[model samples]
Target chain A: MTFTHQSGTAPASTEASVPYLRLRAVTKQYPTGGGVAGVDLTVAKGDMLVLLGPSGCGKTTLLRTLAGLLQPDSGAIELDGQDLVSVPTFRRNISMVFQTWALFPTMTVRDNVAFGLKMRHVGKQDRNERVARALELVGLTEFADRLPRQLSGGQQQRVAVARAIVVEPRLILMDEPLSSLDHRIRVQLRAQLKDLQRGLGLTGVYVTHDHTEALALGDRIAVMDAGRIVELGRPVDVFARPTRRYTAEFLGLANVVDVSADGGGYRTAAGARIPDDVIAGRSDVVAVALRPDCVRLSQTDDGGTPGVVRVVEYQPGGVLHDVELTGGARLQALTPVGLSYSIDTPVFVTPEWSKAVPLAD
Target chain B: MGRERVRYPAFAICFTLLLLVPLVVVVATAVNPGAYIKFPPDGFTLDWFTTAVETPRFQSSLLLSLRIAVIASVVGLALTIPTAVAITRGRRRLRPWVSTATVLPLITPDMLLALGLLIMLVQIGMASSLIGLVLGHVLIGMPLAVQVLVAALSGVDENVEQAAQTLGASRATAFVRVTLPAILPAIGSAAVFLFIFSFDNVSISLFLSAPGQTTLPITMFQYLEYNSDPTVSAMSTILIVLSLVVAVVLSRLGGLSHLAGSPTRRSS
Candidate 1:
């Protein structure tokens, strides 16, 4: 049987063209002074928006407020144009997958998945059917009668996912749900979660500090710091063209250089002049951020800025040459792993002009 | 390792003997063929046990004690579960004061508490009634109930409750379905503890019981004051055996360590 709404209202359509979830000027201040401050975000139906940040950045606060676990000091939360800030959490029709699986230890896997349906007083037949379907979706059908402690970490997390989605909530909030798992399981579950969200066309907000996760799973990434979204855009766009210094440094491995305007060009603090074409049309560019992968290294000191390699570290994919420029600016360049470069070796570094991002002071 | 292996057995034997000797003497006296409560019984017989069970006063007092213990412990649990939940889930600033207040009765001298309750009950005109006795027992039993329930509730992760609320369960439903089941073992252990405490109490029962409503412990005390019979020894032996049975049953159900906030043991 198709999943039906127990409340007699039509299930929210994944095809609805409007933003399914919106938070406007949401502010919740802790007494000790750092909480979410004026966070404004919108999640369109069927889209996944990742809130990416470090610890203490209030991403979790924003997620909790969206989940109605926290009441914002001042803000309006609307889902499908209904005011959600005033709604009690149980009536919000939003589900969350926590960092810790939070599966009820006393309940079996099937019962855990059926909890939301039981809360809504669905018939036992339908509840069992839906629970079976959800467990099948998460590939935990054989473990239905087993308690949470009987499952491995990944399986427990899968149970958590099944529990969240079995409710068919209008919006799903995940607070670093994959953060606790080991690396391989995290990667596997990340792919599964992304596919599941898209296949069901469920709009979701995912929070994480891991850059690879943000880039891999988010349709759009909102880079946050100090309780504010510093950058918001498509993942590739945000990664390639971060407008803020914080975003450029936080979202990618970047070499940030302090530069000054030099007659229609840019000059580093160490007095190396960067060509006009590399400055990217920003006359006010006080600095340029280059990704380590974008800088090319050559031994002949031709057609680029000359620098001495202070450290040559070997990585699996490539070698990293920590280069100190002639005038004392330092940068890293990625080269082939087998190319031998000892410490104190001289090399010339050239920035790929298209990859240089101009930043405001 | 060698020293520890030898020392641990020695300590175990000494400790076991320390606890077993008094109980052994009581049992020996209860089985003594001669009358006069002598240890290292003159010979074995079940006459004192039969005598302790057959006496009308002993029978009535034992039944009264059981009734009071069951009723008072059930009421104590009812009063303390909600209070414990509130104190644990309430404001951070209020927790310490509330906790200290809940446990105040446990630290107070039993004589002082009983005297205070007697005066209060008399002024309220409930003195010497069974209701007054149960109320007094509840006051004394509440601390144990609160301590056990509070530890159990604290062991529960708050996120699971929040998760339930987000899953469309009202606050009350979440508590009953999730929070309550998570701590049920602790609650059972607490009720048993309160029952035993109320059953064994003498001071509060001494002050609260009226004529014909004497509890078993108070009756035993009064009997020992004037009599040299082994019946009191027989009663003590029965009480000890009852406590041991309760302990064994509780362990079989689920151990009491979970009430002390160890992680809940899952039966896989």
Candidate 2:
């Protein structure tokens, strides 16, 4: 079968589109203070919500809570408009692909895939057929009889995915499933997984510390920091208009300028007042974040901030210019390689105002 | 790399000689034509083996010991596998206590446990019977079984069990299907230890066993105390050979060293 993955978005036919799952103020806490605290979100059917964050940021805890591995302390979890707060894990009809691919070492690949079906008491013939189909779905039909140890790491991960999807669960949880893999393998598996998720039209919750993975794979991304979601939105929206400084800086390598109002616009550290519509009050101190792609180097463009190129480092596809402003503050910008200027060379750095976002405290 | 000719250390050679000298002497004394404990045999013969088999007292005692050891080991296995699993899979706080408690049998003095059992068994009117002997053996053997099992449990990748659970197997199913197979070698080692401990137990049987219920070790003690003969030497040699056979068999299944107290063993 051809791989199919429809880009998840708010469908036009809202009347027919229902949420697959919903977490209503779900809060999970441990005695040690390391758990998800008061999370509220709804996942549309077939939507992949990627919980992206640093380590110990409650992404895994949230995923576990969703999977019923850990119950929320004081909130309701609903599946298809039905309350699942009291439901046992096995009966939750939710599957989880653990961070460590937990393949049974003794059982054959086929048996591992067949396990959930057997648990649900599927008949012998039907279970065998579904197992074969599941293996084929993961492109492991020829490896059905092999033990997990016999397969490569990527293959074992695929088996885990297959075992999860074979049950046709209402929702699936993956906890940094690709973090343990080599970069190349991770890329390959991510694409394969996205395709499989779309083809199956399964709702998924993926947890990872990798912002790139979140950007590339999620229909909606939730940027979590210190057990709370600092920002959650479409990947483009969150990256383009981060509501919090941590979210903005975390999504990419960013450069920030502490700006104060001067005249009709904001004056940067270099005393250059860039034009903007957002007003700053006496109590409001603002930081402006600019992505590298939004900053351009100019040797003679007198319209922008005047600075001296203090250092230039050659990167793989580009060269990074560390420009020192008149006030002794520094800003970094990446330009294509071979676009050159010597250190101590006079230059003007221009920020693309359209790409600049005023960060929340 | 240069081909290096390795030489055995002097201490290693001395240790090997120190252990082997008595072993050789015991074997020689067992087969000696003269019915006495001697380093050199007057002539080679199978008379001791024949004598050991034909003597009803020795034969019955051997059977009793074998039966007691087998029962104790099997019972110990039944208790240890589940307890070890519970302890390993338990909540963090419960785990430490359960683990330490299971090993309490190993840490406590054997004479004290034997005495405690003796007092309890006498109150229950079970002392000086095969049941009492079996109970004594289990008390001595269980800790070994638990130790071996815990070591085996530790070697298993917990991810394997989680995988099974996610694949629709219940926690119990995952244990039977995944955890059990991974720890089979550890279980084997535990079984061997339990059998050895049960077979060699003296204090427990001293408090528990009646005249006919005496195990081979107990009977050997009685025989050695009465008469200094080649019979006791022959028995000790046989027990040593049995131990070696068990070790070889276990190693064949998987290297026994892997099942021994590996660093990973402590965690599980």
Candidate 3:
């Protein structure tokens, strides 16, 4: 299966020479070394940037820094060409939707959405209209009078979103806003959020570990590991052709195989010769990241390499076979469910090597 | 019916009667026509109530006690809330020491605490004055109030306040608009405990207040030392009614339920 980018997508609005949001070597370090390291990034106007990472990967610290909830130890943050690091959190025209929703328990849904406008000293008439519009956007218009405790988890999170956007903040920061909901609700809300983000042309910086969420929502994805963005690209590019093994394996079901420059193509120790067009003249390419879908297992002896299937795990649409070559190297191959293979079955592995992503040493 | 099924309700009724029996006897004696405090009245009359109200000493002491209770409770609450917030948000090390000190007052003998206050205030020449009485009452009420407030402040979600700040509320505004309302029930619970504590206190008043200006409890203790009339019972009935009013207010504010609940919001 191939991952494809959505076609016919608009560029939204990009006006200034500088990116709408720019971070210059932002750093916030804890003594425990778990905080965000020096990081630099940029997101254009009306674009969604997703920071994807595992726990303790500093994605949250970075988001909080942007929201002004956290002060970076050292960095320059600019939004709309204005300095943000010097602004207090309250004075900053940025909003965040927390993972826990964080709705004021005492306030009703309407009041919760209105809270931001009220704090900004909006008039009562304008506040009511904006709150109604925000609540309607989240499909929570009828539940406006209900207290947060009375709402479902999904509903409360939507209220949080409404509250964040009601302020029409210069930048919106969301830290795994859907992580706390049920899987079904997460999927549903994720779709609604994507629609809202695109329809409103919102500029957002979302932090999530779920790759699907990042792909569906972010115009650009930043894959972080160990407090650093190891790879930054669009979701399609980052997933289909990662420049590094860290991001390729972390983001997709890609196998990193060690290889060396051989006669016509790179050859793995397993005696598998992968023919990537990009490696034709490269002498320094040492490995290729192989997506399971890119490699195929067949019953022929000379398809590409000879291997014995060691494990067979069945999935809905595909069957995953782990094959060990004569050189003792193991590689994963995903085939159609109909092309089933039992354990210990000798199979010829044929990889579409040209589609394989060549990784730098 | 099984005894196990009846055990709790039986004990409940017994406990309730044990409480009401005293209230009934006091009310009955306050209306008794006899010259001494007695229950199961011979002939009903409210002359004792009139006599209790007419007595200048009773009037002054009761009024004085009310004034002290309100002032001491309000002042104690103001000090207690900030102190609790400080201890709750400060270093975790500070919490254990403060929590231990608050627990100390509950275990120490009342007379010992009163004695300590007397000596300290007398040295400053504040003993036998209203200020001394208020200080003594505040010292006792503070622990109860602070314990509740500290628990409430810490139990609140810190992120809720941060969310407010992100929505454009300043730190002070966030606390006032978000955290304070979240813990309002706890505040009401603490206030009730402090007010009743100061209102009914006799040991502190006995040791601190001047003879003529003693609180109602202390004044009654002295009155019964010589008088055999039912005036003391009459005053006691009124005090009980006043306490009932405060208890009603506490219930309206959800104070009783709040005090019983663990100081934490039910996480979704």
Candidate 4:
């Protein structure tokens, strides 16, 4: 699939309504360094906005600012037209699911779920029914009598989710809630979590360092780097077409090479001649991102870029090949399972030109 | 069968004998027929036991020690809760200094602390008073309580408290409801330790005792100064029995292991 598109921008919300959550020019500086700076974002009602970045990128700081856990040095945060900056964390009526699960070890699952209602002085009868409803929502009613420690890690996170939603909070903030679970369970829970959100029409902002989680779960992905949103768009748009070099590399488009326009073609760093068709009609294309899946391999000289397969790794549905071009540039290609090529096998690499996304940096 | 297995039982027997010897001697001397404390067959009599129990000075001093221990442990525990929370959760990185300063009173000689406290108390006109004794005991008991609490508090995730607060709990309510219950076992253990620490304390009490307001340990030490009688031995036996009960209860509360720096038994 060739991804040919112009520079990307955040699409208008599908509902065409006012944003439910807004952060404007939020900056928090630390004397010892590594804090968020000048962050601006918006999430329409019922949207699941994901903040994805590496460690120390201040995704957490931004989330904390929204939750009123950390006061930003400058800027405003508004949720549902009310200024969250002036709101105390406890009064914000926002629930956060931490990576630690944060279940009360002393309390039984039912009491843990009912904690939010109890804090609000809800009558016992009302609190109990809501608590039971929440347990059934997460399918943990059978384990309601068990303490948090007695439950498995995945069960505990479900309890945390139940506890978070039972309050019917204004906005839910999840800080890598599923990151602590094992891979098999994480995927399963992520689908259910999204379903729960949509079923309730809940507005949420989730932070995670895992890019796959961002691409898989986000209604709209905000790619953050160095405490700044480098790019913001829907998952399909961002993954298929990234405008910056960082976004392409971070999103697994790893075959990025420096290029210079020469006549009607562009000359790659390793001296390979790529025709103007891959340039996407850009007069100032300095680099290109060739996704591994976009490249194809063959045993014959198919007039494609010639390279030797240095490594071939068999994956479930396909084989991943790392090929070193004759011009000394290396590119990775994924082929179907039966396409097996051992090491040092000379192969033709055909990167689909239309799918080769150009980078401005 | 194996040398390693054989060595373990041998060490266990030796350890048991070491603990039992003093207890057996104390029990024997408490029943000594002679005026002086003695082991072997001096003939058995319960006269000294009655004398130790019936004596007014002993009775009053025991009551005084009980009162001081309860007061000091309660106040010291209340004081250290904030200190522990500050060191464990404070945004600043002064934890090293704060932690070291908290335990300083534990390592500094109790006698020196008593002496310093006495001089300061005299300046404030509180010398040789019950307040002086309690002040000294709190200084002694606070370090252990703070250590237990800091370990317990740090084991609790900040997110747990945040989870509560975000659910509409005020800051104080979150701590009292979520955090306090999570570390309740450690708090129980810390309280038990502080109580026991102040109960048998003599070094600080001896220096700080008001006239005629001495504690049980001070009274025992004073009685032994001139008399070689076995009444003190009888009192020692009674105390040994009480201590045995306290030790069992302490173990049940997990105080003994907690004193050895056990962080938490709960899984993360």
Candidate 5:
């Protein structure tokens, strides 16, 4: 597997540059056998690194460990050149926004936001000013005096953000913070969270299962599977050129075709000749994966390999056709919404050669 | 709908009347002008009420009962809150056993428990003393306190306390500022329940109380065995009124319905 740098952004700084937060060999093993396994991650100052994975993939475990809520069995977590593994949660100088919003229902929004300041012995006047500013940042100034239970779900989440940001800790950790909101509200809050992080120059580690959210929010994305990170790179790089079969399939970009060397050229399992440039410098290429978006379909069987349309799925702006080759292998291709084809329609499928990614196994 | 409404009210009235008739009779007997305990008083008089108050035996017993109840409830709370927290937040494997141990007293026969406690106290040379009486009451009241507290703690979101810790509050401070207030209503109800159970208890008090440490209920039971005066009626009425005050206060604080897991009604 190889990575194509489509986004043209430089990679994260190496350890010689003194990253703001550094985690080395963090490992926490649960009795049930699926926990964080020897994870090493680093985040530069004012950058957001998103831990993206499906549920039970140890993404939350990693975030919680960073927040000091869970102790790694053996690891060194350092922030600003200070080791924090032995520090208790309260003294870690970190803030977390929970998925459930976790606001104190008994206290009004103002009190909830001021709780951290009060604990740190911040003066009353200064605490009030900070709380007011935090609330305004989240657009929740008018709901300050109301109890958390009295607010809507989105409003409660905003109050949670205000409470987290008011403390102004060294780092902020968010665990699927927008997972509980409706899609529309989630999109709105996502933008707000991104802007807030950038405006304040906050260093953060966000965890989520949504790829779209990761792409939109992360300066770098770490895609985890099982208990370890399978791929880590810029969002576009990871999405377009996943380094492993699991990463490719997990990111919904797998259209793997078994190929073999036939005489001087490569042919798929269905005996269709693969263009030479697509298999360029590889003598040991056994299979290739193409993204669905990179495959094109035409109604006439004159341009490329011929297949029958098996299923047509309607997406928001386009449609996907599952085309079955004569060799009994199926592949999906995307087409414009104006083009509608019934199942069993004979069509030709062509994979854009430049976008074909070679697979190892 | 109209017929159903009328039928509901009718049933409620009948049920309420059945409960109120005996209490009315007791109050009527207390106010009787005659010395003997008779309903439909010959004339209204304050003699029985005054007599019940003036009696030295009743006075000391009332003080003893109040002291015992307060001590028992406080001790019960001290023992049960940690137990409830452990049961709620500890390992999943131990939860079932912890729950059973806390609720054991509710199903065990009081006489059996009292007998065991009496023997234990006697062996320890603390029988028939204030300490022995309080110990017994605490045992009986602990189950009630633990049950209510466990319910309240389970309803609380654990993340709120974690959030507090990340906000610079220590573990102890987080619990005091977040978990404690969240379960305050349940604690209030449990205290009231422990107090009432200890104050009105007779069977456990029977084995635990010495000659001078007799509680109000034990004293009243002994008095009723010997005399037929209206003094006991007056004492019962006073106890009933005290309990009513506690109930009203508890309801005003919205503790009762909260313990039952119902949404509390707001008074306009």
Candidate 6:
């Protein structure tokens, strides 16, 4: 089987001019518990790489390693070419925003944002200027004198972001900073964070479990699983053509169809023969997978499998209608906005051959 | 069958009666006009109060006890806070053992610990003195402080400290800036408990107090043994009042009872 990058896909941009930080085969093991496995990553200056995975996947550990909070048991970390493996977290010239917002309860917002500058012994005039700029960036200037407890959760999170950036460190790390916010606040802050990252040209390593956030915020996204980075590429590429079966399944729920090797191409479980030209065997498993959006419904006479609509869910963006075919295999179809469809309607479900790729476990 | 009610009023009345007996006797003895102890006074006067305050021995012993208690508690807090933080900050494997070791002092018999300390001090040529007494008080005070600090540290959001570290604060700085403030209420409660333990320490002081370094409890014990007079009652009244004042101060500082009343003093 041959592998191919689909046509009309946008080519990834050239590498960033200056490499801000590089984690060379970094591996962290707890001796008593599992931690991040071998991780090879290069975060360029002004680049944002979001580590996306579920809990216990070690995305947080990778971010912490970058911030020098937790030292990698193996491999070297180079910051702007100089090895920072042994450098302490405080001296790493890196800042991090935690999931908890971590604003200093004793200090007002001003002080919390100014703490990094103070620790670095920044002059008072310059410190004030940077602190004010950061607070203004986060739209928290009015709450500068308020203690952290006095601010709302979103406001506190913004302050945490402001505090990390106030010192204008070369790199910033955020571990699910918006995960604790309400849905509305999360949506609002996501746009704000993207705007801030662009405005400041900040190099950031953001760890998150949400794919939407990862796709929206990260220039390059790394999907991790079981302590290892299973897939890493541009957000679009990772989403559109995942390298591993795990990657395809994790990005979104892809309907996986097991196929057996036939004389020329392959045969679906239902004994339907598929030609070789369609199955781009990228993985070892003899299964073809397609996104729900790829599965289309039409009249049975129009070269589609006979099926009955089992369930119809009207989502905000589209209607997700599941079709149970005569062969007993279920397929889901995403009918876009303004599409007319109803439950229990007899329909024909056909998989989009162009996007279906062979899957592996 | 429905559960039987607790009869809270009966319990409250019994508790009040039990506590009122001592308070009433102490007040009556202090006000009695008689020079000696009596159940019922001929008349009321404040002579014993005046006499108790004027006594140089009582005044000196009180001052010495206050000084020892203050020093001991301060030292004990210094030891406990770091250990508590260490316990809270340690790996999962180490956390349990460290927490258990810190609280072991509270579980062990105070008399046995005091005897052991006295023997150790004597072996080191540190005889009964203010320093030895202070050390003994710290031994008794430390468990209370640790218990309080551990509870306080446990209540502190670990994420806050981790956030601090992310925001350019070192572990120590993060603790001082974030963890300490969050746990200040617990620390305040701990301080009150250590103060009480140190101020009223009898078993440790009995073994450790020097001739001139006698603490208030030691002096009170001596006076009670020698003569069951109204003066002792006056002293007890003063102690009760002092304890009440401290309790109020602590409550104002941090709602100490709320913290102390928790079943899990040191959260795992």
Q: Give Cα distance to truth, residue B153, candidate 1, Å.
A: 1.2
Q: Score the docking of each candidate (DockQ).
A: 0.57, 0.41, 0.60, 0.70, 0.51, 0.35
Better of 1 and 5 by TM-score: 1
- Docking quality category of candidate 6 according to DockQ thresholds: acceptable
Considering summed lDDT, which 10 consecutive residues are worst modelled in model 6 chain A?
A1-10
- Number of the top candidate by DockQ? 4
lDDT of candidate 4 over B75-130, digit per residue (tens)? 88788888889998885579989999989999999889989999999999999888
Residue pairs with clashing backbones, model 6: none
Put down candidate 6 lDDT per residue, B65-138, tens digits, no spaces.
88887887777778778888777677778988877776777788989988998899899989686778888777
lDDT, candidate 1, at B146: 88
lDDT of 4 by residue, A1-361 (tens): 0011111322333662688898999999888888888989999987889998888888999988888788999999998888999999999999989889888878999999999988888899988988888888899999999998888889999999999998888899999999988999999999888777777777889999888788777889898888889889898888887877788877774588778877778877766666667775887678888777788888888878889999888877588899999878789998887777889999998876566778876
The TM-score, computed over Cα atoms with residue i paired to residue i, of candidate 4 is 0.93
Model 4, residue pairs in steric clash: A2-A355
Q: Which residue pairs clash within candidate 2?
A: A116-B167
Quote the positional error of residue A132 for candidate 4 in Å.
Answer: 0.6
Candidates' chain A TM-scores? 0.91, 0.88, 0.90, 0.91, 0.89, 0.90
- How accurately is candidate 3 docked according to DockQ? 0.60
Q: Report residue B85 deviation for candidate 1 (angstroms).
A: 1.0
Per-residue alpha-carbon lDDT of candidate 1 for residues B42-156, written as tens digits (9 for 90 to 100): 8888889999999898999999999999998899899989999999899989999999998999999999999999999999999999999998898888887888888888877
lDDT of 5 by residue, A1-361 (tens): 0111222232332322558999999998899888899899888877788999999999999989988899999988999999989999999989999998788868999999999999999999998988898888898999899988778888888898889888887899999999988999999999988877776766799999999899999988999988898789888888876656666667775587777899998887777677888777678677777877788888876578889999999987578889998778799888888876779999888877567776554
What's the C-alpha lDDT at position B260 in model 3?
Answer: 57
Candidate 5 local lDDT, B1-268, one digit each (tens): 0113434578898999999899889988999888799978888888888899999989999999999999999988888889989998999899989899988987999999899999999999999889999989988888877887887888788898999999999989999999888888888878887888899888899998987788999899999999999999999999889988998977765555555764321111
Which segments of model 1 are wrong by more than 4 Å? Answer: A1-17, A262-265, A277-286, A300-313, A324-329, A343-354, B1-9, B253-255, B264-268
Clashes of each: 0, 1, 0, 1, 0, 0
Question: If candidate 5 were superposed on the true structure by all CA atoms, what would the RMSD be?
Answer: 5.4
